[model samples]
Target: MKPIGLDKAEHAHVESSNNATVNSEKLDLSKVKVEPLFEKFVDFDTFTKSDFRIVKVKNCEEVPKSKKLLKFILDDGSDKERVILSGIKDNYSAEELVGKTLLAITNLPPRKMMGIESCGMLLSAICEYDGEEKLNLIMLDSNIPAGAKLY
Candidate 1:
């Protein structure tokens, strides 16, 4: 999704205002703005039916030979487990990510990344600054059941 009129000065101002340091080497959200030609609406029911759920991150490890890939083992409150690969290594450490709950798209078809089979996608908000990508994993409060659907 594109954000309109997003510019480097605006990005730096926002980050500094929030007391969030812009990791220029990793994420730079100051060069491009969202172009204005994208659709702005979606079918509510169909969109709601998309399989977004809360899952506990049981394990996390770096994918061999890949600097960006991190493999995660997630529990979705079922006997079957889901394995996902996310490009958040630059943003998070394995120890910090383990035992945390994340929202995931559980029904996506499996895709191979770095020879690893990923069955789902861990969802996070991303921002680009100076052509660098940064991820903000969704945080939750209290204890929510794993596999609880996002409404």
Candidate 2:
């Protein structure tokens, strides 16, 4: 379905200028350019469906043959340890991430990468400055127990 005043096909690689015709009158369009606006909202039910849990990083190491992958063993308060692969090796080191309690989405389906099955995803924020990107892992403030559900 297409929304009102939001057609992408009409707006293409066309060039623009200050001069334009309007009913036999010259109009300066440079000052009256139409800037597209976007507003997307996610419903509450869809937002709450994600299972967020507190997991402690029991172990972390760089994935072999991959410069961007970092393998982590997480303690989710369960009997079996969980495995998560993150592409944050360029931002954080293995020694810095180990033994740290962080937020993770634990309900996602396991994904295999480089023969390793990642059971969860670590939460991080990407900050951009001067065309450079910095990824910082999200760490909770309080001393939350492992596998604690986030409401």
Model 2, residue 53: C-alpha shift (Å): 0.5
RMSD of each: 6.8, 15.2
Per-residue lDDT of model 2, residues 81-124, tens digit only: 99999988777779967878889999899999989999989988
In order, candidate lDDTs are 0.72, 0.74
Worst 10 residues of 2 by lDDT: 1-10
Candidate 1 C-alpha lDDT tens digits along 83-127: 999887777777877888778888888999988899988877665
Candidate 2 regions off by >4 Å? 1-38
Pairs that clash in candidate 1: 3-34, 8-30, 28-128, 28-129, 28-130, 29-128, 29-129, 30-129
Judging by lDDT against the true structure, name the best candidate. 2
